[model samples]
Target: MNLQQLYYFKTIAQLEHYTKAAEQLNVSQSRLSHAIGDLEKELQVTLFVHQGRNVKLTRCGAFLLEYVSQSLDILDRGLEKLSDFVNPDTGSIGLSYLGSLANFVTFCISRFFEKTGKVQVHFQFNQTVTQTIEDSLMEGHTDLAFTTPFDNKNIESVKIGSHKTILIVSRDHPLAAQDSVDLTTLANETFVTYSPQCMIRNHIDEIFQTVGIQPKISFEALYDSIVLGVVSANLGVALVAEAVDLTGCHVKALQIENEIPEREIHMAWVKDRYMTPAVKCFRDFIMESGMLLDQYKKK
Candidate 1:
């Protein structure tokens, strides 16, 4: 019913042991049990089932926990916004992006800071999958996200530019000397690739599917740099965007002869969401700096 009761319930639900929960909360076990019991009475529902040492949430308890978690998450976001407003000179901006765009995004961020040093930025590198990048924005976890386009009406996005996903192999690789190579040529070669959850990996998969060739994906990685490093180690070849940092790795980036569309990068945010001054300013700078310009100018 109250925040204290909900807090007690959440803690007990997580630990599933009243005694342990009490110790962790630095309160007496009786007090912990009394609070939870009062909460159950107020809600008119049995929230837990206990077996001597362990406690488990009943179906109603589980449902309540879901909503309780969501409420706490929203409260956290509100507090963050309030803090940012109170300190406008150093507004905080939460940014989310794919690993492949690290170099380009970093360049943009550095440029932004050069112009406005007072802004504080927090970054969430979502190497998991494309969905998470979008989710970060929609769930209020991040203010803005750089990712591929998705058909989510809840978001408003603007296309930045497109970049080519070039083929990368070790300098001593068998096909490295060639000017360009067909996708089919690498069919038998062991492949190092991004996780299937990655947007670029999905695009790469589609290219292979179109050519009717299934590559032997021996290893999976999240970042373009890591994939390239794995390839340079002669572990396997990979397909990564040209924005990947290749300074230290001895790798050859070959053009793919097969017709593959360039990867489209977009900056997306939740529609109608309040944009902090920091987020708004940097977003404008990013759009103007040409970092989002069509680097791969496809004919």
Candidate 2:
């Protein structure tokens, strides 16, 4: 009927002697008899037969013993698996990142696997457009996120590094011959820029305001690659991360003579969530060594 009762029956059936079973179980003979009696009455079956001074298991008792043994074994195994599941040292760790940090993040992932060999890592990429992705972090959809800094009171942030937003121009563009150009030099050039809410757009706006020049906007896009692709076609010059691969795009990254602050990259997570061992190891790994990525290196 219950675990204790089943255990009592199992011990008694194994010994086949009421007195010996009571002595081994450390219970009085009367107490053991009452418990067994209760079980037999509940099951409406005789589980033991008295044969002179000793006892023998009934047919039902032997069958029940086999099943109870298997049931207990399964429960024991389940407990152990549950214990392992809760262990912090190993398991899956979830992370979300901005697509721009791909190169830097991949480097860190290799380092993490080298240090913690057995942990399973999970990762997702988010464009970091609005509160949606940030809300995902807070709701436990991800344990960590690499993204542009934002004002979110529920999130905890760590400054990893910043990337210079360089000017990408077509190979045939007039300014491509120059090593660098001032922001004012592009004042009359139709610019390919990201959406208004994009952090890169904000930086460009700040530079324009500081130099007292309004950029002549020609095209706007949601993604940096599209903006770069357009610039490669000579439609216009665009500002983008210095690390963006311009290989087949036929674009060149040029430094800016006028001051334009680098776009910041940060690692953020929910403010007070419990970090598992795998997550903690990864978080510490990034915080301690993330700045060394070449994309983050200042040229």
- 1-299: candidate 1 lDDT, tens digit per residue: 78877778888888899988988889999988888888889899999998789999999999999999888879879988788654645676777877667766666676677777754665445544587877777889888888888889999888888878788889988887887889876778898988877778788888888777989999997667678778989999888887676788899888888887777789888888888776787777776756354643331
Best candidate, TM-score-wise? 2
What shift in Å separates residue 64 of candidate 1 from its native position after superposition? 36
lDDT string for model 2 (1-299, tens) is 77878878888888888899999999999989999999999999999999987888889988888998888779889878655544555445666665566666677777777877744555444545434557778789788887777687888888887777778899989888987888886668989987875656787777678777888898998776788789989999987777666768888778888766667778888888888766787788888775654434543
Where is the poorest 10-residue window by lDDT in model 2?
122-131
- For model 2, the superposed segments whose C-alpha errors exceed 4 Å read 1-90, 118-120, 124-132, 293-299
Question: Could you tell me how far off, in angstroms, the CA of residue 52 lies in candidate 1 after the best superposition?
Answer: 64
Instruction: Note the clash tally of each candidate.
Output: 0, 0
Q: Candidate 2's error at 19, in angstroms?
A: 18
Q: Candidate 1: TM-score?
A: 0.64
